[model samples]
Target: MSRNIYAFLAIILLLLQNCSGQKTDTKFYDKDFKWSIQIPKDFTKVSAKEWAEKQQKGENALEETTGEEVINEAKTIFVFKTDDMNYFEANYQPFDINIDGDYRENNRNVNHALYQTFRDNMPNARIDTLSSTEKIDSLFFYKYETKIYLPNNQILDIIMYSKLFDKKEFTVNIMFTDPKCGKEMIDAWKNSKFEK
Candidate 1:
């Protein structure tokens, strides 16, 4: 009986140590003349340089659409500083009609539209706006969270927004699931410094 008690005590102590061993660190991403941001630790940093390069290459691909199509597809969570306002201007020109109203009735739209519908239907849905706090590097940003229901009844907690680096003429939009995991992603972004 004494040996069993000793074994149990050892297991309890090990469990406590394991729990206490977890650490949380704040990571930042900095860019020259542009805004910086924080990437949480839970998320894996998926090559910021590659994303930027893709954006640069795809700039002209989106130009073929008319203004109306652009507005319909512009469910962007964040807009970086390098975002071409000309694209926005071309897509959101002075049209007296409500673009959302026209698109809201369509069931064939993508996940963003579906998420919007879920948000509208939720009785407890709320938007928490975070002030621009703690510059990741040089970028300025705002963060917001909203709980959205998926088609399977699973609730998706999301953190999203755009970071602007005006001097670098670049902008970054980050969208992620699990708000708790955002801390890690924010940290990775901070560590990367957004130079690429």
Candidate 2:
């Protein structure tokens, strides 16, 4: 009986440790945007040089594929990724000077239409968009969640948060191959704030 009790206690303790361990404390501040977020310990950010090189390579490939001049107006502030295949990226894009529409809905509307189009090509994927904007910090972000079911019984989930401010659109996206990581990120982001 005592052995069984000890085993149960050990399991309970382990669960408690895991729950407490998942709380994020490491904060990343973006001086340019005056934004801050607590990042999970499991994610690692690559060096700026590497990021720039990769960004250029990707843009080059995109330009080659489209046969058009590709201009990148977005500045990527950080890209955090985990070994478990979860990806988190943050960037801000300048709105075209001649862009028309409500400033608040411009970026969100474009992304909504674009993502809605993706549903037609992905028959096996389930996508969910929030009916209303959720305010995180100083911006009201349009939220989206996607789940892709694979043939081998695996799943990939994607979360997107976006908002427009002062003629610039800011976006944060997280692709989670691990549900636990997604939960952690969601929790961390819930506490996000604009310090300015």
* Predicted structure with the largest TM-score when compared to the true one: 2
- lDDT, candidate 1, equals 0.28
Model 1, 1-196: lDDT tens digits are 0001111111111211211112223334333323244433322222334333333322222222111222222212222211111010000112111432222122123223323433444446443323233455564543333444445554444333333222111223333343434444444445545443
After superposing all C-alphas onto the true structure, candidate 2 shows an RMSD in angstroms of: 13.9
The 10-residue segment with the lowest total lDDT in model 1 = 84-93
**Which lDDT value does model 2 have at 91?**
78
Global lDDT of each model?
Answer: 0.28, 0.56
Cα lDDT for residue 172, candidate 1: 32
**Collision count of model 1:** 35
Query: Per-prediction TM-score, please?
Result: 0.32, 0.67
Cα lDDT for residue 24, candidate 1? 26
Candidate 2: segments with Cα more than 4 A from true spot: 1-25, 49-70, 100-105, 112-131
